[model samples]
Target chain A: MNRFKNNLTPYFFIMPAVILLSIFSFLPIIVSLGISFTDMNLRGLANWSTINFIGFDNFVQLFQDKVFLKSMGNTFIYVIIGVPMAVISSFVIAYLLKLVSDWMSTTFRVIYYIPSVTNIVAIAVVWSFLYNQEYGLFNYLLSLVNLDAIPWLEDPFIAKLSLIAMAVWKSNGVSMLIFLAALQSIPKMYYEAADIDGANRWQKLFKITLPSMSFATFFVVVTTLIGWLQFFEEPFVMTNGGPLNGTNSLALFIYQEGFQYSEFGYGAAASFVLFIIIILATLLQFKLRKSEDK
Target chain B: MDLKNNFERAIVNTVLFIGGLLVSLPFVWMILSSLKNEREVLSIPPTLFPNAPTFEHYINLFTNLNFDVYLVNTLIIVFFSMVGLLLNTMAGYGFGKFQFKGKEIWFAVVLLTMMIPGQVTMIPTYLILNEAGLTNSMTGIILPGLIAAFNIFLIRQFMVTIPDDLIEAARLDGAGELYIFFKLIIPLAKPILAVQVILTFIGSWNSFLWPLIIANEERLYTLSVGLALLQDQNVSNYGLQMAGSTFMVVPVLIIFIIFQKHIVEGFNVSGIK
Candidate 1:
């Protein structure tokens, strides 16, 4: 009897979370998968709306949509630029801080991490000001050196760049902290040995620091890629994917289709496509990491 | 070598000092502009000082925006979700430590859902809520969020560290599951709970996308959603927007200042960074 009760206990404990997940997470996906098969739009209901089974039509239409294509391109561009910039900058900052006094390193780490913890909306507000067209801090700084006021948000090209730059600022702190942990884990003896070999600072960094953090680097790269793929909030908050949908990410597109336009069926289809892309990207990352390790 | 290294250190220090200032420039500007009057704020070559800083905007948010409604709404949703999280933690402990049929399979299924991006299922979620007529209700706002698989995983990982013998001893004492969960398990799991609370609070606080979708009524809007609405209405009103932004930023800052150690410790536990 005791053994039976023990066997049942785990299920009993997990029951609440499992039930909630089944309702919110699992049920929604199943419903979405079902909804993807039909032309369920704002004019329709689930059971009542003569929902025709339009196999691959939605996905096909998704490819033909220029806005969807733009979203895909912008999302990739954001991910490609934002992830690497954030990872590289954070790692470099973390690596350099290691050379500073211990107290200073700790202080800088926390300070650098402040932006990471703050909300994205708040970050967007501050950065939008800095990226302001007139009397903006960034343009003012550029002006001091006789540079033209770059239309940071006004131009599509510069708008994407502005969003990406803000993304790096907002994201770098967390990656930096992760890199700091990876840095701390490296044995001092490896560096001491490099010193004996007359390895200079650059050599030591390239040889010892970078190589030792391979796992963490891989981890950061994967997660960062995943994050940047879903680049919604920054652009959504900062630019509203303006000044001509230049910064409109697929995530934002998904948001716009569903919320702004109320194209639920089409939005679900786009989102599923995005999910597939993310899955493929994650798989590729893992494959690459495995090959490098080998 | 030492002197030359010191000289290099001096150069690095100068660069980093500037870098730090550049990094924190927005925050500094945020604080400054929030205090400034309209002219001082938008002035060409903006003044560093606000001259006559006022709490008018903060006062304005409280009066006009009904920022307190959003605050209360946020608190209510976050509080219930925290209760749900407590239940989640208990379940996680049970799963991690207790023996059950299909335990690994169930755990795998739970973990699998985490990988499925929340964005993908968002439309269906809105549909579900709409069908159920829970839209514009606090229950709708907090109910879906309460289904946190990540928290379950986090708490499960934490529960594994608790010695099994203590639980066995409690079982021997004829204590029921609820008693063990409340008296023994919860007391032992405070550190992990602390981490979960801070993370969930921040997550719930900064939650924008979901709340914006479900909570159609302004009265039900959380601060993040409210801030977004404020920005949409007053796109060019940088001063008022900044004020609203400052209002949102300040509470989180206050929470961080008071519980920074716990916040960092929570991040460590959650493996967020």
Candidate 2:
């Protein structure tokens, strides 16, 4: 009887979360999968009978759609460009920070993290000010050196770059903190041994520092890749996917299609595609991590 | 951690601080520019200092925009969602140490949900809420976030380390599970609870997409939604928007200041912020 009670004890503890997840998390995924295989819209949302099964029509249409393709390309560009830029910049910043006193390091960490925690909407608002074509800070800074005001948001390429720049700045703190902790953990003996060999600064960095942080590097890179791929909040706020559909990300496209356009089927299909990409990337990362572990 | 020479050290420090300055410039600009008039904000070469600094824009948000309503609505959603924190801890404690049928499978469900980027679940979640007649209701916004899989995992991480002997002792004293949970486990889990509260509050307070969808009525608007509405109404009004965003940014700043250590520690463990 006592053994029976213990078996049931875990059930009581796990029941609430499991039930909620079944409702909110598991049920939604199943429902979304169902929706993806059908032509569901606002009309269907009102009258369930209007929904009709359309096998792969949404997926087929998504692949052919120019805006969808552009958004997909844009998301790839962000992840590809963003991952390296964020990781390297943060690593460099943290390495420089290692040269400072403990208090100084802590102060800078606090300063850097402010943006990471700030609402993306709030920062995006500030970004509009900085990106403003007429009298924005970027143009103002350019004028100081007699350079013409480059259209930060108007030009597609520059617009995407500006978004990437914001993402790198916003996220670098996480990598910085992670890298800082990893940096501090490197055995003092390794550096002391390097000193005996008269290793120069660059030599020390290349030999001891970079090599030592392989796992931390992997963590930052993989996570950043996943994050940039789902990039939505920036474009949704700053550009609304753009002056000419340049900044559109897959997530934004999914949101616009689902909520704004009420193309529930299309949005679900697009999200599933995005889901597959993320899973593949995550799995690939795991495989790489495993190889590194061995 | 060794400094090579004065020159090299000086150069690295300067470059690092300059990068920091670049990162911080937009925020500094936001505050400085918030005080300026329309023309001053849109000037060709932006003024470092506002020629005539005014709180007029902020005044506009409170008076014309009914910023107070949004503030109260935001607070309500955040406070209600604290239930999620309690639920997460309870569920986490169970997963942490309890042995039961299908525990691994149940835990996998929690972890798997974390990997699913929110878009996949969003449409159906909305449909589910709509079916319940919760659409356009504040409860629609609060219900979806009442428990998060990531928060469950975080709590589990904290609870697993808690020696089983402590709870086992209570059980020996004829204490019920409720008594052990409320009287002992809760106090023990205060640090992780604080971490969860800060994270959940910040997340809920600043949440845009869900709130945007649910709060169709102007009266139900949260700060992020309100800021977006403010932008839509006056597209060219920089000062008004900046001053308005300060409403969202400042509370978070206050939280960050007080909970700096926990927030950073939380990020380190979670690999997210």
Candidate 3:
């Protein structure tokens, strides 16, 4: 009895978390997959009898969905452009930070980090003002420089670019800090050896710094790519996937279908598609890394 | 050599200084614009500084827009942060220190689920909550996120580094399991605990999508939801929007400033590993 009781102690410690995750995390994944096959809508939500197993119809319609296809295309564009921009800019900023005085580095790090901590709604509000067509900061500065006041968020193409720009700005700080930590972790002996060989700054950077931080770079790129793929909040708040659905993301599309339009089955199908894409992308990156290692 | 080094230092300093100002520009604009009257805010070739600073919009948010209620609702984040910290720490300690049947499997489950994007599970979670009659309540908003898998994993990673002799000695002393956890393990786990606290607080505070869905009623709205609704209702009211943004951002900025070291260190710990 005492041995049995002793074994039970670990379960007691872990029970609450297990219960929570079973309901919220594990169960939801299964339920979502189940729902994706059915024709669930507002009426279906109200009556279980109304929710019929519609087979692949939802997935079929989703592939035929122009807006959904556009959203998929837009998400790819975001990840493709935004991930590299964020990684490169953060790497540059982190490198520059290393060269500065400690006081300046600390102060600038805090300033750069403010956006990451600030709520997305607040960020959207501030950037919307900055992106305003008339009497806005960007256009006002443009006027001072004798340039055209380009519509930052007004044009469909520009709106996507605008959202990407804000996302990079908001997200750069955390990645910068990650890069900074990686930079700081490199041994000083490597740099000293390079200096003894009379290597220039560029050679040292490409040879020593970049190669050493490869794993950190990979981590940032993967995480950032995954994040941008699901990109929802910025476009949701700023444009509502608007100016002709140019900025719609798969995540936002799912939200619109599931919650806004009450087409739960269709949304679930779309979400599953997104989920598979994300997993595949991550696995593909790992494969690429492995091949490069060989 | 000295002159060249000084020149490089000067160039780096200038570049970083400009970058800092660019980063700060939007926030500065938000605060300054919030202080301006509507007319001044709309003026062409906008004024960098508010010529006539006013707090009317801020007053309006509290009195007319139910921001006070929103603020109270946001305190739910604090409540969940504390509860989540307790639950995750216990689970972490259990996984880190104790041997149990299927322990590796369960821990692997937690780690694998961490990679699943929250969006995939969001629809079913909402449906389940609706079935439980939790919709349009604070309970619904806080339930799904109460014990994050990532937090549990982070805490577990930290707690595994804690020495086994401490737990062995405490067990030999006839201390209860609960007593050992509350008294011995928690005190030693302060660094990770601090990291968990900041992460949970910032995450819960900034959370928008779940709260936006669950809190359909005005009084139940968190700050992010309430502010988003306000923006929707007042798209042209730049001053009012700026004031609302400022109010929402200031508390987080204050917390970030106070815990800057922990915040950076937390990212570093998560990133490198």
Ranking by TM-score: 3, 2, 1
Candidate 2 docking quality: incorrect, acceptable, medium or high: medium
**Which 10 successive residues of model 2 chain A have the least lDDT summed?**
A1-10
DockQ, prediction 3: 0.66
What's the distance in Å from true for residue A237, model 1?
Answer: 1.4
Please give the CA lDDT of all the candidate structures: 0.82, 0.87, 0.89
- Cα lDDT of model 1 by residue, B1-273, tens digit: 111477889876776677788788888888888887767778887788788988777787889887899888878877887888877896788777877677888788788889989788899988898899888887888888886888888788888988999988998999988899989999898977886787777777777777888888988999888888887887666777788887777777677657766654345613422
- Among residues 3 or more apart in sequence or in different chains, the pairs in candidate 2 whose N, CA or C atoms overlap within 3 Å are none
Between prediction 1 and prediction 3, the one with superior TM-score is: 3
lDDT tens digits, residue span A61-110, model 1? 99999999998999989987888899889887887776678777766766
**Candidate 3: where are CA atoms >4 Å away?**
B1-4, B270-273
Local accuracy of candidate 3 as per-residue lDDT tens digits, B1-273: 111488889999899889888888999999999999999999987888999899999999999899999888888766886797799889998899999999988898788779889889989998999999999988898888888898888888888888999998998899988999999999899877886788678888888898898887898988889999999999889999999999999888999999998877566434472
| lDDT score at residue B55, model 1, on the 0-100 scale | 77
Please give, for every candidate in the order listed, the TM-score of chain B alone compared with the true chain B: 0.91, 0.93, 0.95
